[model samples]
Target: MAGLWRKAPSPCIGICKRPGGICVGCGMTKADKKTFKRRRSKGERKALFRILIERLDGMGRLARWEHVYRRRCDRKDRPCPLDKL
Candidate 1:
């Protein structure tokens, strides 16, 4: 007997922004949040997992902010509010 299972997709779009403290595009919780100020390298799965946990713990507030930002960006002929700052 076999059970149905599928691997989740990688959450990396390759754009790294330090200001947001996370990937604004791919929502890569792991690579974006890992503490690597001194070293520039790719994070391992364990480090990424830790970041995922942290993000999940604060998902409500993050999701709300993302929604608000998206709405603000949706206006015609207007740049995203995030872009201005």
Candidate 2:
């Protein structure tokens, strides 16, 4: 049970701009963000993260997000997947 409560990495970049109900930084919709925060399954969270990454990439904002993501991760002292981006 304790093992099921592991922390999940977020896709936030601190540049939250919800234009058209979608965030420009992480490419998640307002509803998606809400669900993401409450999600408890590691696999589900990871899948969401991957989808966000793909969305960012498709929008041509992947590089910019990567830069901000590194800073965000550093501030939180968390590991980022910048290399994977």
Candidate 3:
């Protein structure tokens, strides 16, 4: 059972963030501060990269839509004062 677990693929992509931050995309938890420390096979890494790209693309689209909504609201003279709350 231990060998089966060991053979299971890792979730690390080579594109790691600085200071061991959790990946915003694949959500891979870093075991250490060193970048690319997780020993994932090439195939695993490629899959992780694809997931990361999809996550980023989704986030980008959401952000653009949010910006457009905010701009539209502003143009209509809607007073979005934080202090009003």
Name the best candidate (by TM-score): 2
RMSD of each: 12.8, 3.5, 17.8
Residues 1-85, model 1: lDDT tens digits = 0010011123333344434565554345453434333222233433543454456346443454445444644533344323322
Q: Candidate 1: where is the Cα deviation over 4 Å?
A: 1-8, 12-21, 24-43, 61-85
Candidate 2's error at 29, in angstroms? 0.3
The whole-model lDDT of each prediction reads 0.39, 0.71, 0.40
Candidate 3, residue 2: CA error in Å? 26
Error of model 2, residue 84, in angstroms: 7.6
Candidate with top lDDT is 2
Q: For model 3, which pairs clash?
A: none
Tens digit of lDDT per residue, candidate 3, span 1-85?
A: 3232224323332345533455542344454223333534545444544554455455454344334434544665553221121
> Each prediction's TM-score against the native?
0.27, 0.74, 0.31
Error of 2 at 70 (Å): 1.9
